[model samples]
Target: MKHEDMVKSLSERVPLLKKEWLGIYRRMGEHPHAPKWNTLCGDRLFEADLESVRSFEGKLQKERLNFRELPPESIILWCSEMERRSQWFESVLNGIDIKNDWCRITPMTRRDMQSKLEQIVPLDADLSRLVVNPTSGTTGHPIPAPNHPAAVGCYDPLIQYALRMNGLNTDCSGDKVAAIQICSQQKTIVYHTVHSYLEGAGFAKINLEQNCWRTDESSAFYINDMHPVFLSGDPYSFLDYINRGIEYRPESILSTAISMEKIVRDKLHGYFRCPVVDMYSLNETGPIAYSCPHDPSKFHILPNDIFVEVLSGTGEPVPEGERGEIAVTGGRNPYLPLLRYLTGDTASMNYGECSCGEISPAIVNLGGRKLVLFYGKSGKIVNSIDISGIIRSFPVYTFSFIQRSDYRCTLKIAAGGELTSRSAKFMKEKIESLFDNEIKVEIESENILLKEKTMPFICELEL
Candidate 1:
């Protein structure tokens, strides 16, 4: 069965998938090489718009394969071709001018974009293949998303493919494992192998807000039967484990959907005894970028599907090697197509060849969603993970810092394991020094933060 059919059947049973899936799967079978279209990307990979996605059958024709059941070789072949196309896509996308084909492209300013997003999408009616979507990160609350559904569809497989390329397969048969998810209280997002609707693969889920930072004999009792392949969580949640120190370290560890600083990533990487994989994506746009183990500083874009541009604040393109706002477009998702969508993310435009030999445009030092508040002193906006990193260095079970004012900030640490007042003091001093001015630090030790009140390390700007 094709992905669309599978989605339709499941949607009848579970209506939630209907609102989540953007109809990009119907067009996925258009081409010769395609994987099963399950859903969309949240904080996973960059899902670029596919050209032939406007019509349901057209999108399927582009991918010519039923993605419901993917073969190992097909994924392998797709990865090999992805490496080849990355370079080719980089060359073509770099030269695109807004003057040429407005139907193929369009640009929107950040201020007007946040206010008038839905009205801007109908700019090209013929371009119905491109759908609309939204993206929110750290402090940049939620940007208006008008994109192609084909782009969103592209994200699901690209993410799974990236995970498989990283030596972890989502389709782990017979082998039982567990995953730690921070997305929801239930951790029900089943993108990975064990995060399934059917069987959990012997998984044990703990909400990051619940302050289950450390693993002990009791916690281990839940996962002792099956040796888990990996533990996945946001960098903040991972630090909760790193702070108290995880009792049992899995073979592999994955962190995504939120920003992680070098210092924090290093600490988590050491604590887990594994490499931390960073994924760059948006809720509206889908997963557009992921960190390759071969290259940690840069994340490879899911090419042909995702077309990216680094633009200046004034809406003009920036020079390579200069810092600019990252903009993205194009994918297989028919429900939305973000054209010249201004991603609040700031990154340096890189055009040089990478050591990995992949040709697509790769972004380095992705400063997420303008969470870094640039105080007027030297215009240094603090990234979300930067604060998270400071608290992580201490022995706090779980922590979330709130930006109260320019110089004032509050730290709320949930107590778990053996965390005490001494650990909270250590955390305060570490993060207070980060700001040069008078910093008001408040530490609220909660036994457990409620589910609805779960504050991710970052929240988008509120309009």
Candidate 2:
């Protein structure tokens, strides 16, 4: 208990050294490289191009990577290494001599885990194996993910490395971070305003939450004074800042907390005039993998920290190049030991050798949880993301379009900024081009989860 109290106190005083103190304790925690990564983390998001980041649709259909390439004898060694990294996970997955409260807390399902989240994860508790297990929430429900400090050791470093892949924070850096949709200890609110999260102590860069970026002089204070590296934004903001009356460029391009289409990414690249890259991750899971600059064909898993499996609906492992559900074996957060955990999303592996040439298995065609895109006058055809590419050209990110009726299509968007004549016309033209003469675009901007209140990419009207 004395050690626990001492470590917690030290963490609060020195946030940067959080993980190190946890490592010294009798009890071990998970979330390898968490404190270190969390510090470098803290940024906003937007979507990216190709409907896919690294893989092409044609190749994902033809090739998938195989797990057989990995050594079978590695599990024992891997377990040992993981024990050093995430003791909480090691205790749960592999039997450990956890006879005390320090390591033997019963794992929780998403439901029972909430109340104890903070109790388990003390702000001062670095990596003493007492992380609040976060739920993957993929069973259309949540799984209890216990916090792991050691996992963060490597996981945090991986984040910094991936950001460098995009040329971010070489020298210029800041303290402020932004988010379009922020989930705190409280409710999920559309993090539209920059000042909402900014209290007395702010970071060095701006974490631009999606909503409306204030066009006032105070925004200029953030631009010139804070000089935040713009983490992410919609193409509308990245491209039409001239209409927005501010011409600020960020140091790096951090994409994906929201869905930014290929069209928008092209414009964002123009606006930042830098390497704009997107990563695959969710709020529950920190950045899991990244796009290797040398290979746009596949994603390299942070294999040092995570174990990923592509499985079919029946929980059977799918062959390379075969579409299947993504199952996560190792999570950076030991508080969350997501073993054989099913992620509702779908994807495949790269069977072919990647042009970039990293030996890590290339993950391609993550295709689950997607709304099937249907088009043509009678709505008789299925377009999927391929035909739906043009739909992403709009400024608003949250939207659902349907054509149950022949000529007319109902366009529902999450509401944020009230559509002016200019914005509305832009909306109508986009819908018309896709469905043509009979197409009618109804800007419901409501109906779905409130856009102003979310960071949902494209909440397609479920067919």
Candidate 3:
């Protein structure tokens, strides 16, 4: 059947399609490798709504092509069109009976969503059909969030946007993706699944810990044989891959979940000779932005799926190029729609045209949550990124830090091989210097269970 005809048929059978997808998800959730398998299905389903996805893709393509040609008046009309499509925002505006006054509605924070998920969801939404997704709690405490199959399906187009921005062909037939990360104890350590969008395409998720794979060499052989188009993983998992000398070069590398430092990115590029795309996303908001092909520092927002705003401390819009809390509105997630949700992260906005020709608003100097900051002596705020960077430089298997008090910290580190005194002393000195030598840093060599939902930084200090 032709693509347009297929889309039309699928649209007519929306109810049946939803039922089939739900059944597939339920069956996969019961599998031994449930987590990985479900992820693969969710990603492929993003393309399940062929007509909607095509429309979205065309809109993004048009925005990029006409970015330079768009006059000031045309840009304003384009933005208004985007706002009109935000169903969640429209519902809220109607509920409050506020017309032509979007700013009148108060902005929401993560905590607000956590406490009142039902209120945030559309009133007419079918709750029974939505899936429950829990946040990873990397920034703050973990929270249960609602998700619809259509929302999960939106990932298909967002990922395509990222791939296109990175200069990869969107027609990925026979391509494969490998995701390396920790998995739940209930799931199989290594498993593979097929993509729904492309025939013969495959997806695999493997845990690289000692318990999962016997040796790095064995894992390397398995990965090379699969020969995935791109390898995706968190920073720590990617670091493990590099240290273990797993020398299989893929077409590209995607680093998500956490930020990637320049040194690590450069090293990965040196070894793989492929584009290292840093993806900025949240579990609640799916894919928000991705690194520009021409410059990794600038993140081009996914305008079709998300609307981003940089707001000051008082909840007012900040000037371009100024740092402020990131506020997101109009996501594809129908079950958990958000409006002006404060993301707890700080970034500066850039309106200048990107070298890659993507006219979408860009976010520069992206930093993690403010909650990750630790209090030090003399009112010094120590960033968790700095602490993690210093420790990641060592040959550790896994690590976590617990702040017992304002001036005391306990470090639990699992050694990959040997934790020598020289390396130990250097770590202590570096940490102590960051806290002005007033904070006591105690390092302990013990095996820390690196769970799927593990948070690197934990603060037990009472405020």
Candidate 4:
């Protein structure tokens, strides 16, 4: 679309676009070294929809967030609403007693989202407004999740709430850049767009790779010039940003899409001299939770609409504060009404007040993705969780574990010279014992994990 046409489309969708912010938006596009944007995208939110988001954000600030009831009454109403509006929900929730809990209903998994998406979408949903969001699928099962403009727009407010919890606010004027979603991966969509909800503060999703820019230093120069109010990206991307030696500082940082280690967060906080928030979010479910300001190990839920629960393997709720699979129900997405959606992450649910002054329940010991198993040389299966536990013991920054079909494994670590030779040797031995003394563990103590797209765990052996 032409630049004028794009603005026109945005104005049609969001009538509240300010005239002053157009300069920033145009400047971001016309920069000499601006990224070769793959496509044009915008938050297709109508004015009223954005107002609803602002209202929810206000409510989030006003309310003392509390622990979600096993199946909150709001969830019951949402299910009934979905049943009336969706064919899939009507079929799946046909005769279930939802008031009790989600124990009886089969929790929705990634497979359901991958194959039964059409059935999962509400029948009354507007197809024209629905956005197909492709996930990176760090867990190995990538799915194109159904989303909406208004739903995507809500992320900003959630991010704001997270910042507020940490005693920092990212809400800025139209003349400034609102936020930048940076990616350090080999391939990703790079674009510069304006958010109507943000009052037209410029937003850009740019890649830090040298190929994406006009020169090696162009990325750093552009970033320094933009001076986004806050930075949003994965842990690896943030690490890459640090390694690139960009000098710009923002009010805060929102790290999402993957779990970030404490050592990494501390590193970012120290270098940036700002709050480094570890946000637990997914494309399917936008902005699940944010790390507590007082404790990086705990995460406080963001949305008031969603009810989070921890369930056992058999689809039963575990006792309060016990570790189990994190399952979520109810969300603001019109296209996807999640009902007991198994998030594939594990955490213990804790209720009551937190040191951060939020009265909501916090997700403790939040683990990433589902259980990934690697085969040992003796053909025994080793859980990724065990390996993660071992890694946590060391002063590791970022690491990747990959096992080949021949039972050979390599653990690539990036510790910024924090791991001593003896510590590295001991860590290698500990990982080897996890494989029952079968596979020799190779450790690469370099800064490679931050430069590329590396999975935390990869298993090639045929199970």
Residue 185 displacement (Å), model 4: 1.3
The superposed Cα distance between candidate 1 and the true structure at residue 443, in angstroms, equals: 20
Q: Which stretches in model 3 have alpha-carbon errors above 4 Å?
A: 1-51, 63-100, 175-190, 214-216, 369-463
In candidate 3, which residue pairs get closer than 3 Å at backbone N, Cα or C atoms, i.e. clash? 46-153
* Candidate 2 residue runs with Cα over 4 Å from true position: 1-156, 166-215, 229-245, 294-297, 351-353, 368-463
Ranking by TM-score: 4, 3, 1, 2
For model 3, residues 1-463, the per-residue Cα lDDT tens digits are 4645643444342422342333322332233423323223233244445556556667766754222111233334433443355454554555442333444556777656655665666667776657765434455333456787666655655676687679765365333442333322212335454444433244567765444554536566666666666777666566667777878877778877677777878887888798888888887787788998888988888756456778777777678788998877666666666667777678988876788877777888988532355677678766565576567557654567788865589777766456687898899888878788878899887664344224568877666
Would you list the C-alpha lDDT of every candidate in the order shown? 0.48, 0.42, 0.62, 0.77
Q: Using lDDT as the measure, what is the rank order of every candidate, best first?
A: 4, 3, 1, 2
Worst 10 residues of 4 by lDDT: 446-455
Judged by whole-model lDDT over C-alpha atoms, candidate 2 comes out at 0.42
lDDT of 4 by residue, 1-463 (tens): 6878867865765566767767887888778868777767777777688888888778777864475546767678888888888777888788887776457877887557755888888877888877776554464334457788778888888888888788785465467798888887555678887887677888999988778888888888888888888889877788779988988888889887768877888899998899888888877888888889998789988888888888888888888788998888888988888878887788888888887788778888888753356777557656564576577567665567889888788887777466899999998998888777888999887654333224678888886
Model 1: residue 433 alpha-carbon error in angstroms: 26
Candidate 1 lDDT over residue span 232-294, tens digit each: 666656665555443677756666666777787788777767656778777655666767777
Q: What tens-digit string does per-residue lDDT give for candidate 2 at 1-463? A: 3766755544443334324323322111121211111122211211221112112222222332234323223333454554555544444545543222211223322232333344323234455444442322212222234534343333233444555655565532122432121121111112111221121112222222223234344343444443344444323334334344445566666554333455666776676677665566643455556666665335666444445667655555678788876666544453554444445456787644455544456677754232234455555432333223333334343445555534356656543355465776775675466554455656565644432212122323344
Candidate 2 C-alpha error for residue 391, in Å: 27
TM-score of candidate 1 relative to the true fold: 0.52
